[model samples]
Target chain A: MRGVVMYTAGDVRVEERDDPKIVEPTDAIVKLTATCICGSDLWPYRGIEPADHQVMGHEYVGVVEEVGSEVKNVKVGDFVVGSFVISDNTCEICQAGFQSKCVHAEFVAQTIGTQAEKARIPHADGTLVATPGQPEPELIPSLLAASDVLGTGWYAAVAADAGPGKTVAVVGDGAVGLMAVLAAKQLGAERIIAMSRHPERQKLARYYGATDIVEERGEEGVAKIKELTGGLGAHSVVEAVGTQESFMQAVGATRGGGHLGYVGVNYDVKIPGIELFFAGIHTLGGPAPVRRFLPDLIQLIWDRKIDPGKVFDLTLPLEQAPEGYKAMDERRATKVILTF
Target chain B: MRGVVMYTAGDVRVEERDDPKIVEPTDAIVKLTATCICGSDLWPYRGIEPADHQVMGHEYVGVVEEVGSEVKNVKVGDFVVGSFVISDNTCEICQAGFQSKCVHAEFVAQTIGTQAEKARIPHADGTLVATPGQPEPELIPSLLAASDVLGTGWYAAVAADAGPGKTVAVVGDGAVGLMAVLAAKQLGAERIIAMSRHPERQKLARYYGATDIVEERGEEGVAKIKELTGGLGAHSVVEAVGTQESFMQAVGATRGGGHLGYVGVNYDVKIPGIELFFAGIHTLGGPAPVRRFLPDLIQLIWDRKIDPGKVFDLTLPLEQAPEGYKAMDERRATKVILTF
Candidate 1:
């Protein structure tokens, strides 16, 4: 099998790797039908995060090729979608809907790179959510997104308490941010504001349910949000970018007693205690517990209630994984889907 | 009128000052019945926070001496307890139960020091909660506690979602922390843990319903909390100290899906983004929106359901407010009350 790997910063390659196989009673071998590069993947590609032959992807929609004896819910020949974080969903944390921090959880990229032709999934029954049926080819990208970005955006919206009567502000123009706009809209936010400088992304954000687009960034962006909301700021804010500027903007754009849900993989960010304290808001952040939402999201996708796959602007063969990485690294694509 | 004033760092004096008079249509002048030195007051006295010729004190229970034309809920001769942050209570933020961040909010200490013969309270109808009747002198200290610490602790418990079946951990052993233990108990937390080093404070914490005590500080303290909660950490944590160590300990001692509520007046603290992001906890902080809880708190105090006044170990005449400040600054008193 050929999979994506990074030898060093900006040194991505598609090379031959050993095929995945079931190694534990709770494991399953998945033949990835689709996978994609993530915004966080750029962290290492830009030298901001260290990488030494690190396997590249975590999101995947696949068909189970083999299942171990203990994997009861999922079996071979099943079309499934799995979260980036594997969890034994029965654990206390997972049962409480924080599967991302599940007691027996592990990151898929750490054990089996999903960008490969085949990958081994641990805690198979709990981590993988089978679609009702084999999804249409065009729906593959959307299903892959449910593995991380879509579910993450959904969690962000839920954490921010986005619903009827809420004015939601999203900071960031990336895939996750756009998805968050969609989630907020789906969650019934009365108004959605997308902070974006790019006309293309701004258009997509509007298409996804953003009622307003603020082209400014940082303090100016926060001021614009306040101006739009009668000087009170938005009732909820989704921070999909993890920089200090983005975090502060999210916090600043939220009204007193509002919620700020941040999902970006934090880089070098520090929250000032005085400002955060005086801000008087609720904040919940971390890796999105995607597994918790997979069932409903998969149903939504299957029923055509949402088309989050539109986030994938570029598509390529798995062998062209390096080019897929390059497109996202250069900001030439919102997301790149790789089909095997 | 005589009021408490900080002439310099650690230098408190009771000096003659102009008597407060109603200045706003929503204002009322209150004759201080009881006032107390807060844990936060020690910040300036210890030189951690700057002090000049600043009027001191923000917590008080008093009798309404005069009312402006628009003061409706509270009137002359009414016994009332007011929050440290005076708010109009009708603003959207206040209506949403965040009076501390109310649009028309004002800090009592900045406008009219509470530790005085009489003080002017703005937004009288909103900031002051009148008792069912003139509270007995024996109830003065407890009513005074309602003005800040007790309300703050209640807010902390509420913010942390302390309720049946939850395990709550309190950081800091100050009056507020001890009060938080009491609040958690009243809020129905199944188990309450107080982290303290002082024997007296620990005893008070136990009396206030702390089911466990962890005397270790910093990482060791967090380790103990994890040990107590089956290595999963507490379900809810109250941070009553504003230092970085206390903040981090609160975050660290919370389970992945737990809640952290911090109400300490932050001095110099910065939350590292990466760790907090990965902590997977819901966090809410700020000055306590005490006004939101005053009605219920006052009712409880009036009904003799709680005795938060026990936290005030030292009582002095208003003329000896300086000594009260000294006692609190030197750690001789958990809280000091000054009576007229």
Candidate 2:
């Protein structure tokens, strides 16, 4: 089998690798149909996060090629979407809807490279959700997104409490941020503000339900959000960028007693306690429990209620995984889909 | 009139000062019935916070001495209990139950100290809640506790979502943390764990409703909490101390999908982003919006359903305020009350 791995920072390679087989009774062998490079993938590619022969993709939409005796939820020839974080989904944490932090949780990106012909999925019944049936050719991209990006963005909106009567502010214009705007609109936010400097991304943000756009960053951006919300910041804020400036801007943009949902945080960032204390808002974030929302999101995609696949601006074959990484690393593509 | 003032670190004095008079249409002059030294007061006295003849207290219960023309909610001779922070209550923030961050918010500790014969209170109608009538002499201390400590602890419990079937862990043993234990009990939490090393405080904690006591601090304390909760940590955690260790311990003691409500944050503590990001819990904290809880708290105190005044262990005449401060600073008293 062929798969992707990083020999070192900025060095992604697509090379022959031994094929994966069911290692446990709960495992299933997945023949990946589609996968993608993520904003988080850039962390290792840019050397901001260490990468030494590290396995790559965590998101995938695929067909079950083989299943162990105990794998009851998914079987051979079934189309499935799985969460980035593996979980049994029966633990107290997972049952509480925080599957990402399940007692048996493991990050797929750290253990399996899904940007390959095939991979082994553990806890198959709990982590993988089968679509109602085989998906249409056009729905593959959207189904792939349901594995991570779309579910994550939806979680961000839910955490931010973005709904009717809410004025939501999104800080970032990347794929996840744009997805968040889509989620906010779907969640019925009264007003949506996207902070982006790029005209192209800003246009897409508006297309996804952003009622206004601010081309500023940091303090100035917060001021603009306040100005738009009548001297009170937005009632809900989603932070999709990991930088210190972006985090603080998101914090400042949320009104007192509002909610702040953040994702994509960097290891180097440190939040001053005083600032958060004075801001006085409810905050909930971290690795999203994508599996919890996979069932609903897949249905939404299948019914054409949402088109999250539009976030994929570039596409390539699995053999060209290196180019996919490079494109995302250089910001040439908002997201890149890889076909096996 | 006489008031308590800190001349410098480790120096407190009771001296003659101008009697307060109504300054704004919404202002009211209150003759204090009782005032108490807070855990936060020790910060300035110990030189951790800057103090230069700073007027001293925030928590108080009193009789309304006078009111400006526009003051309607409270009037002269009415017994009242007021929040430490003044707010107009009509602002959006206040209406949303965050009166601490109201548009017209002002800290009484920063401006008019309440530890005096009489003090001027701004935003009288919004900041002060009148009791149904003059209270029995025995109720003065409990009513004073409602001004800050009791309200703050209640807010922490509410923010952490303490309720039936939840396991709550309190990270501080000060008056506020002890009050939090009481609050969690009243809020119907199934189990309450109080973390404290002091024998006396632990006894009081047990009396107030702590089902368990973990004398360990920092990481070990977190381990004890997890051990008690079947390795999942507590469902709700309250951080009543502001130090770095206490803050981190509070975070570590909360389960993945749990809630952490913090109060009394120091200015210098910086939370590492990676740690918080990985903790994956909901957080809501800051200076509590005491005014929002004033009415209910006053009612409870009036009905004698709770005895929050037991937190005050030392009582001294107004002229002996300096000694009261010394007792608290030297750890001889958990809390000190001052009287005219």
Output the number of the lDDT-best candidate.
2
lDDT string, candidate 1, B187-291, tens digits: 999999999999999999999999999999899999999999988899999999888999999999999989999997465798999989999999998889999
Per-residue error (Å), model 1, residue A128: 0.5
Candidate 1: which stretches are off by over 4 Å? none
What TM-score number comes out for model 2?
Answer: 0.99
| lDDT tens digits, residue span A170-275, model 2 | 9999989999999999999999999999888998999999999999899999999999999989999999998888999999999989999987688878888988
lDDT of each: 0.91, 0.92
Candidate 2 off by > 4 Å = none
For candidate 2, give the DockQ: 0.86
The C-alpha RMSD in Å for every predicted model, in order, reads 0.9, 1.0
Clashes (backbone N, CA, C under 3 Å), per candidate, total 0, 0
lDDT (tens digit, per residue) of candidate 2 on B1-340: 9999999888989999999878899999999999989988888999998999999899988999899999999989999999999999999999999999898988999899987888999999999999999999899988999999999999999989899999999999999999999999999999999999999999999999999999999999999999999999999999999889999999999999899999878988888887888899999987899999989888888899988999999999988998999899889999999998
Error of 1 at B153 (Å): 0.8
Q: Candidates' DockQ values? A: 0.81, 0.86
